[model samples]
Target: MFFASDNSGPVPPQVLAALTEANTGYAMGYGADAEMVEVTKRVREIFEAPEAAVHLVATGTAANVLALATLCQPFETIFCTPTAHIHEDECNAPEFYTGGAKLTLVPGLPGFDDKMTAANLRATIAKEETRGVHGPQRGPVSITQVTERGTIYSLAELQELTTVAKEFNLPVHMDGARFANALVALECSPAEMTWKSGIDALSFGGTKNGLMGVEAVIFFDPKKAWEFELRRKRGGHLFSKHRYLSAQMLAYLTDDLWRDNARKANENCAYLAEGLRRADAPFLHEPQANMIFAALPRATHQRLFEAGAAYHLWDGPLDGDPNEKIAARFVCDWAISRDQMDHFLALIA
Candidate 1:
């Protein structure tokens, strides 16, 4: 049983099929092919933003850093949560792409793990804005959907956070590495969850959902379309044989595969969370989408590890007493089955 991360799962058959179709004959290079045009059109239609500018990159990091670069100047700061992926995972790609822009982390919601509040945002942005060009001026507010702690920010919570950013005229950027998972959980339209609710740019992700590796940086206003394209090319993200990326994305979007894949992943997580809770395990943060952070006794962890189960420990070692609950993270993917989840639960038990 593999619960390490969604990243470890197999790609769906449809994605492989699309890739095969794309490989049949010659196509144009450098994202000039017809496949990309269809992918772009489909994305715009899905978001209900007819004028939105959409670009695809091979990694979530490229999409996020490039999008931030398009939104903010070099000296500005992007407001975000302390545990945001851009802050913890991307290794300063945002700063590099934005030519020295920095991230200012906002704190104090809960669970290291709760939603960012308007008060915190106002205070943080206010502090940044007071610098008068001395400090990093407030730039965009970057939010992570299905945030780092496996919790989701509700639409109201999201709107309120964005409202605070809007008050300071800060554009909102969502680092949506799990965008589909969050959207399915919220049961909201893409536009409602994004632009209509004050988001300016979104790193619409596909990698964790089921795609091989592709993410879209979608700007609601197309004004920066050319700038983003230029930045994408200059940053070396514009794939020379771009059709492979396009094919994967197209397969992801076609027939709602993206949503279905995320739903399955989320359902698997919910099931796993249920199993853990039934076993009297306490969660570090509640499972909301495709990820969960929970604690089990070190002995239980040892048992699972010896059983050949693969996953991550949030912190600390695994050589303590049987009753010492240590933190762990569980991520689910579409391909993980009921049998796999139950086997994992049994091993832990």
Candidate 2:
């Protein structure tokens, strides 16, 4: 049972098939490929932003850093939660891409894991731009929909944060590494989660859902489209074989495959969450999408590990007292089956 990460899952056959079809014919290089043209059109239609500028990258970091760099300047600071993937996981790629732009991590509520509130964001934004030309200027506000802790920001919460950013006249960027999963969980339209809710740009994700390695950066305003293209090339993220990336994204956006995959993943996590509750395990946060953080006895964890159940421990060690509780992170991907979930639960029991 592989619950390590959604990134570990295999690609859907549709994606592979699209890649095969794209391989059979010659196409223009760079973003000029016919497949890329279709991808741009499909994405714009899906997001309902007829004027949106969509670009493809091979990785989530490329998507996020390129998009953020387009919105921010070298001297400005990006506001985000401490647990944001750009801050905690990207290893300074944002900093590198923005030519020294700093990330100001807004502290989360005391009990929550780095999901920021409007109050926290307001205070954080106000604290910046105080030093005028001496201190770092406030840049865009970057929000992660499915927070690192696996809790999603509701529509109301998004409105509140974006309202605060608007008060500061700062743009908003959404790190939607799990966009499809969050959209499925919220049961909202793509536009509702993004531009309509005041998000200026989005790192539209596809790799985590089912694509082999492709992510889209969408700027609703499209004013910075040229700058983004230049930044992408400078950062070495521009794919010479661009049609391959385009093909994967095209398949992801077509036939509602993105939605179907996210639904299956969320359903799998829900099933796992219910089993965890029945096993008397405690949860660190509600399983809102395809990921969960749950607590169980170290002995039970050991048994799970021995039985070949793969996952990550959030806190505590595996070598402690047999009955001591430890937190573990379980991520359910689209391909994970009920049988795997059942087998894992049985081991814990």
Candidate 3:
């Protein structure tokens, strides 16, 4: 049983079928294929924006970095949480792709929950932009749904964050590597969760769900589309035989497969979390999506690992006292089943 990451799971049949169909044709290269054309149409139709510009890349980093670079000048700084994937996980690709635009982490204020509210953001923008050219001017604000901390922002919270950015006349960007997961949890319309919330750009992820690799960069204001295309090419993220990537997304969006996949993964995590809670395990963060971070005794950890159940220990070693407790990071994927989770829980028990 592998609980290391959703990225490790097998792709759905839809994805492989689309890939097979794409392989049989001699399509145009570099995103000019018919499959890509359909993906753009499908994504726009779902987001309810006929005029929206949709572009596809193979990784979430490309989607976030390119979108931010398009929205910000080289001298600007992107504002996000210190725990945002763009800041902590992407190795400064956002900065590198944006020609060195800095990331100004918005430290969560006292009593603030999983999100940076409009007020906290207002205070941050006011404090940071006060430097007057001596420091980085305000660029776009990037919000990570299913935060690295495994918590989600409510629709009201999302709207509030976007409102804060709009007050500063700055565009908003979302690092939605967990877009489907957040959507399933929030149970809101794609438009309501994004554009209607004043989000100007989105990094719509597919890799963490079921696809081999694919992510879409969607811009509500289509005016910024071509510049992002150029930035994507410049960043070397533009796939040459791009139909493979486009086909994956096409299958993912068809018949709401992305949403269903996320729902199943989240359900599996909830099941796992229920089991952990029943065992009185300590949770490190709010288990909102497919990822769960919980602490168990070293004895339980050793028994689980020895039983071939794979996951990552977050805070302590595996070779410690049997009574010592430490946190572990567990990720459930779309393909994981209740039976598998049950088996894993039985191992720990």
Clashing pairs in 3: none
- What's the C-alpha lDDT at position 74 in model 1? 96
Estimate the TM-score for candidate 1. Answer: 0.97
The number of clashing residue pairs in each candidate reads: 0, 0, 0
Query: What is residue 12's positional error in candidate 1, in angstroms?
Result: 0.3
Q: For candidate 1, what's the RMSD? A: 1.1
**Model 3 reaches what TM-score against the true structure?**
0.97
| Residue runs of model 2 more than 4 Å from their true location after superposition | none
Clashing pairs in 2: none
lDDT score for candidate 2 against the true structure: 0.93
Error of 2 at 23 (Å): 0.4
- Top candidate, metric lDDT: 2
lDDT of 1 at 301: 91
Q: How many backbone clashes does candidate 1 have?
A: 0
Candidate 3 lDDT by residue in tens digits, 252-340: 99999999999999999999999999999989887999898899999998888888898999998888788999899999999988888
TM-scores for all candidates: the values are 0.97, 0.99, 0.97
lDDT (Cα, tens digit) per residue for candidate 1, span 38-128: 9989988999998998888999899989999999999999888888888889999999999999999898566473457778888988887
Find the 10 residues in a row with the least total lDDT in model 3. Answer: 108-117
Off by over 4 Å in 3: 109-114
Cα lDDT, all candidates: 0.89, 0.93, 0.89
